[model samples]
Target: MRYTDEELEVMLSNYRQLRSQLKDIRESIMVPHVIQDTNVGGSSSGFISNPTEMTAIRLAEDDVLNEIKNIGLAIENTYALLPKHKQKMMMAYFIDREPNIKELEVARRLFIDRTTLWRWKHQIISMYQIELEKLDSV
Candidate 1:
């Protein structure tokens, strides 16, 4: 599927957020919860389970996981179509969080000048737009 630049950015942001959420969800699911015994006065004791809430959390996690998978696939498909340099640039800037680094630092890491890095960023975005258009046409 094709996406506009804004749409793609939003999807990527959502993907990142969902990933963090999935981590939290997995942690929550893994840890066992303690249940207080309600029949302390009686001879028998039983633990109460809230199936509804448990089921809801599981279902929500499943949905988020599926969406994350789909978004990843879409990203991979697009990345596969890019040239090696573009792929590396995209990975560095987006996936690897290089953009968060200082401009000079990122440029040094990529072995490019700061001005060229900025230029390549624009070119890469344009390439993505063209690629997305091609995918849409298909």
Candidate 2:
């Protein structure tokens, strides 16, 4: 199958939009909180049989970090192809090591609801997978 210039243009635009949102998503990983509770290993009666249990609380959406990595890579491949508006937004949102940009701020700045942000993220992952597959096929 083949894509016309318009279709390619739209796809590229969507990628940039998703990349912008993805930029913020990548920065939103929760700081890992390790609960270091010292179990005195008291009387054996009610012992933690294993003695230690570990759990993690992900404050932000978990998969977003993973998707950010994908978006970063795909953006690298396609960055030169992006328009200026998209380039700046995507770069600032995703690739920079600047201060943490809050999620609510990002949502408000993009004029999108939280759920739409999630859907955009999902689309980025799907599009990245498709692009990667095409490269692999080549």
Candidate 3:
């Protein structure tokens, strides 16, 4: 169940993207779609129920949803296990990382040297990989 460091980093890097996708998916599933009736002169039963509820139920069974939920849950759970300072480092490095920011700047913001930043990243990714492995075992 061990992943290479590269693979672990790739997964960690996807945290924000996965979260955004999850949010979009949830919103799409929850909102009711307007269906246009094609019937011109056909007799109708006039017993139309709310489509939003039914749409949510059907979309809830999607395979992609399960995969995203499992991965997202594991990520959140692992993040929760980190110490407060490590959590801050993770937020700065991955979750809230801004474009065009360099590694040195991130280290400076955290008030740590480049070496400590590298070490902390290693530790965080290792913990995250273990969490993913645990998810796979289940």
How much is the lDDT of residue 31 in candidate 1? 56
Q: Write the per-residue lDDT of candidate 1 for residues 1-138, one digit (tens) a residue.
A: 555666765554354565677567566554548533457676665443676665455556565555555565556676787788767766776666633587678678888888987887766555555655554454
lDDT of 1 at 99: 37
User: CA lDDT of each candidate?
Assistant: 0.62, 0.48, 0.80
Clash counts for all predictions: 0, 2, 0
TM-score (C-alpha) between model 1 and the true structure: 0.46
Clashing pairs in 1: none
After superposition on all CA atoms, how large is the RMSD of candidate 1?
A: 8.6
Q: What is candidate 1's CA lDDT for residue 71?
A: 62
**Higher lDDT: candidate 2 or 3?**
3
Q: Give the range where candidate 2 is weakest over 10 consecutive residues by summed lDDT.
A: 51-60
Tens digits of per-residue lDDT for model 2 on 52-104? 22212332335655444443455466555455654444444444413477655
Better of 1 and 2 by lDDT: 1
Model 3, stretches more than 4 Å misplaced? 1-3, 26-61
Q: Tell me model 3's lDDT, rounded to 2 decimals.
A: 0.80
Off by over 4 Å in 2: 1-73, 76-92, 96-99
What number of backbone clashes does candidate 3 have, counting pairs of residues 3 or more apart or in separate chains? 0
